[model samples]
Target chain A: MLEYIVLGMVNYEDMTGYDIKKYIESGISVFYKASFGSLYPILKKLANKGLVAMYESNHGDRKKNYYHITDEGRKAFEIWLETPIMIDDGNGTQLVKIYFYDLLQEDKRRELLIRYRENNVTYLKGLYELEEQYVNTRNKDCYYYKLSVLYYGIRIIKETIKWCDDIIERKDLSEI
Target chain B: MLEYIVLGMVNYEDMTGYDIKKYIESGISVFYKASFGSLYPILKKLANKGLVAMYESNHGDRKKNYYHITDEGRKAFEIWLETPIMIDDGNGTQLVKIYFYDLLQEDKRRELLIRYRENNVTYLKGLYELEEQYVNTRNKDCYYYKLSVLYYGIRIIKETIKWCDDIIERKDLSEI
Candidate 1:
């Protein structure tokens, strides 16, 4: 819900669901994301709320639905923007996964820990590319803000990888 | 939803919703959140799923509804925990707020900007507390990851506050 609204309001002048999803995955949304399941549902809901309107374009075999923000939508977005919204589910799964890392057999837990590190590295690679885009664009101010988020991702991932390594090698989870 | 699930899984030993809420607020979930709304709904759903069972108690005008994780719920939470989840929400509300700063009347925008800074400061305050907690609880290996988030929030808020201050002093929006 937020990812599209943010995309519609920020990155591109306008976007379709596919475009938004692609943009999000392109490392632009290291902070925000909308899955296809969530994205399709939200687009319909936003249009119904009269904050967004969609137009269909014929692309031969593919008909494209492009969503544009309405005055009402922009206003609504701004209102939401102004409001103090608490982000829930901030890092629930990772913590839970760690909290229950003991649930797995020791070796399986060791393997999962290694895999998590690999995942972090993969994500950091995407962030690195996004950082280049922001820098090349020379929107230094905005780019820096994006970089700030990227840096945060890097730091956390580094920390996770380190923690997991220490856990796997450190003799015991109960001690640390 | 997650809060209740986590709480119920823990509470399989026995606990109250109040205890669950307090535990979450106590910085145990510095990364994620589970509010009463999400918690109550999840409790009902998990119960319906036969993953949890709830019993109500009337204690001095206070009704403490407690939840227990059934074996099914434990299995479900374990499965849910292992699901490969993603974390992101990269649409820039901060930039959205900055760009539209002009859309707001001069006085309103400045107030809004100040309010944003103030809010960021409050958020930074929380992060700082988490940083302290992480430092005390964990070794240096985890410091960078945890401290990085703290620094990210702190720096971004600092940058934003500085940006707003510069704009206010120079009356930059007059050009707009």
Candidate 2:
């Protein structure tokens, strides 16, 4: 996943390792995090795999290695983008895909959003059933803390569903 | 963190490795996850550390090893519960603390929630500042995808703030 994020970022524009880290911190830090320890190693591995090409650029007295996505890297990123969004995938996965949705065709983007909504709707139903079961049983009274945790899941999923609905309703994806 | 989670669960009641896994699936699967592979190793490590004790129990035709929290385990769990919640801590960390919050004194729990709210409030302010900067720059048109990702962070943080407010406003913590 880190590799894909790196690829996606470089697909947008060439970036030094520091630049990639900065973009991650500024853009997706809320949902995901990558430390320099992990970032540099992943960059090296991607370079070795021929997914990204690194070139050194000099600015004043500093020479920095800048990464640009190779043709292979772009293909790999597109595959990741089109992969189905599962109900159990982390929030970061969906967010990263949507952050690059402009690279996808409009129809494909709409399809992914609808699929995402459908998956969450199914998940929400399961959560409601679990809630009902917990309420009917002795667990509800003795385990309100666990119940609150469950409610947190329900609330977040509901919010995600609402976001999907709003995006679908908006006639223009660009405006979103 | 996995060790702490294991201790917290065993601190509640004696549970077999299977029981802990089931509880995690039902209770906090949304925010955190642990597979049996990792769970068994942690359980073994906890026992080795004298933080938890294991004993065999016969259930009809089957024998099970159940983990019980030791005196040391209880102390560790308490320290974790009282630790300050940071703005960048994952949602799982906060939820796990709250799941065992009943073990803490009423005053301590209240303090943690207040602190949690305060931390998120600070984070939300930074996000809003970033949003304003993004909107004011050329980023507004060309990078709406990135902006949407930023909005995801903002929306989730706002919901979290509201949850904190709701919890704080309720006169009774037990009802939460």
Candidate 3:
């Protein structure tokens, strides 16, 4: 959550609750998920904890709530930055989804495959473009991570596409 | 969750629940996560639904439950394979962590910095090994995706390290 918050800060300087959700979803792979229900509350908590400072502003007729990292927030972020994250054992969503894939009818599986392929293709193309964008604009440190993410995105899509082919070949689900 | 299940199927052809969990965490940079709290119930539900069928064995005086994908489960997985996933949006822990870095005391910030650096470096090294492993393996499609993840892993580490350096150069947080 903090990494994303800082990403918002890095990307937009200062933004409101709405901005964060928009930014993450637009390019943040299907694997990465967040909800506003938790986001707003988390923001409030961040402010309360003094990790983030909040403000209110009006744009046109709309009132907007804003948050920014405090110096204290930065310090805290730095500390978090230094810490190592352990890959604690937990549920794997991809596996669960696949496990139950057979529960869906053949047609449903086909629909899913088509949709998944389309999604991956679109995402991969966009990522390729983004790589160009980063290069064309000379985006530096702040932007390099985007490249990393994009690379992963494309790779996953390619692999998924291939996996779909393999499964189809092995099982011949369409014929069945 | 489905991905984890598939992982279980693919890794060693068949696995007990414990073996499944260990296989994923140790081998794949898997997207699956499961908890004992949820696993038993879900497993039973899957079995009930015919997505998975099970067998039991006694090992070292302990009862073991083993599951394998059924034709129905395979079909279900296939259908799911093609479906487009809805990627939920939400908080990024790293971003959130960065946002609040300023809240900590100087020593705390330094501590975070140290921890973050250690983590990134460790992960970065692991990524390098993965890349090499990918190079040596026949699963290029999967390895491609792994490489992509590693790419981001590297960029994120660089950013974190750079931030730590920036703090050291720009401020004297020691007295704070």
Candidate 4:
């Protein structure tokens, strides 16, 4: 999966490992993230497999290696893109916590639920701001589908906020 | 995390590794799942740490080890329950593919979007069925908040389906 992501980014433009990390953090961190530990190793493997070509350039005191996708990499990526997307049930930790929340006392459960709700509010606000930025700086060549992904993020976050509100509301009702 | 889940199930009642896996698959697999490989090891570690007590029971030429959470385990689970839940952005692979979708031909892109949309419809149907089952069961001790997690799953899948439709519609407009 990381290999495909690396190939996807390299397919966009030539990038050093650091550049790839930066790109993921800025644009796609909401849905995915990778640490340098996993990033560099995958990059090395991809380069060795001839899927990506690494070239080094010297810039004064530093040497940087940039990766460019090969013809084979593009073909592989195209095949991967055709594979159907699986519906992710999402990361399960939070849901598991909620299921077992009866273990906590009333005050503790309310505190956790409130904090979770607040976090979603903050996250949704950030997604909205990002969408606004994309709209304001719209590029004619920018594929509409690209922006649609951001909307996907925004919509889910909005639903999450609503879920949070409902949970908090129910907690209040139970008290009365 | 697996350990916490193991403790969570044991907190409910004494269960062997096989039982835990079965319970997760039937009840919470929508949000969480575990393989016996990881489950047994984590269970063993928990026993070693005195967080859970392992008991052996004989059942007609078979031996089963059941785990029971200790007092300390309950205390730990209580604290863990209070920990705030993080909002999952979901599996990033789908979003990542969408972001780079311009690399594909127009027809291929539409095909992928349509397939993705259909997959969400299937997922949404399953969630609705699960919700109905929960409502019908109507166990007095069944916590409302636990069912809210299923709602969260249903809501996100619905939003994802809508996003897929919007992208498909936008693609058609672009063709015009």
Query: Scored by CA lDDT, what does every candidate get?
Result: 0.51, 0.79, 0.49, 0.67
Give the least accurate 10-residue stretch of model 2 chain A, judged by summed lDDT.
A167-176
The TM-score of predicted model 1 comes to 0.38
For all candidates, the clash counts are 5, 0, 77, 0
Error in Å for residue B10 of model 4: 0.3
lDDT of 3 by residue, A50-149 (tens): 8788888989989899787877776765444333322222211232133224334566556655665565576557556655665677534433322333
Q: Give the TM-score of candidate 4.
A: 0.52
Which 10 consecutive residues of model 2 chain B have the lowest summed lDDT? B167-176
Docking quality category of candidate 2 according to DockQ thresholds = acceptable
lDDT of 4 by residue, B1-176 (tens): 66776787798789999999986553333345588889999998998999999999988889999889999998887565434322344443324445545545678777777776776787567667766766777662445755666666766777777777777767432221
Q: Write the per-residue lDDT of candidate 3 for residues B15-123, one digit (tens) a residue.
A: 6767765543332322334555566676778778877778988888998888877777766654443332222222122222332233345665566556655665765
Quote the true-contact fraction of every model: 0.15, 0.33, 0.08, 0.47
User: How far does residue A98 in candidate 1 sit from its true spot (Å)?
Assistant: 29
As for model 3, its CA RMSD to the true structure in angstroms is 25.3
The C-alpha stretches of model 1 lying farther than 4 A from their native spots are A1-11, A44-53, A59-63, A70-176, B1-13, B37-176
DockQ, prediction 4: 0.17
Best by TM-score: 2
Deviation of model 2 at A172, angstroms: 9.7
Which consecutive 10 residues in model 1 chain A have the weakest lDDT in total?
Answer: A92-101
- Superposition error at B162 for model 4 (Å): 17
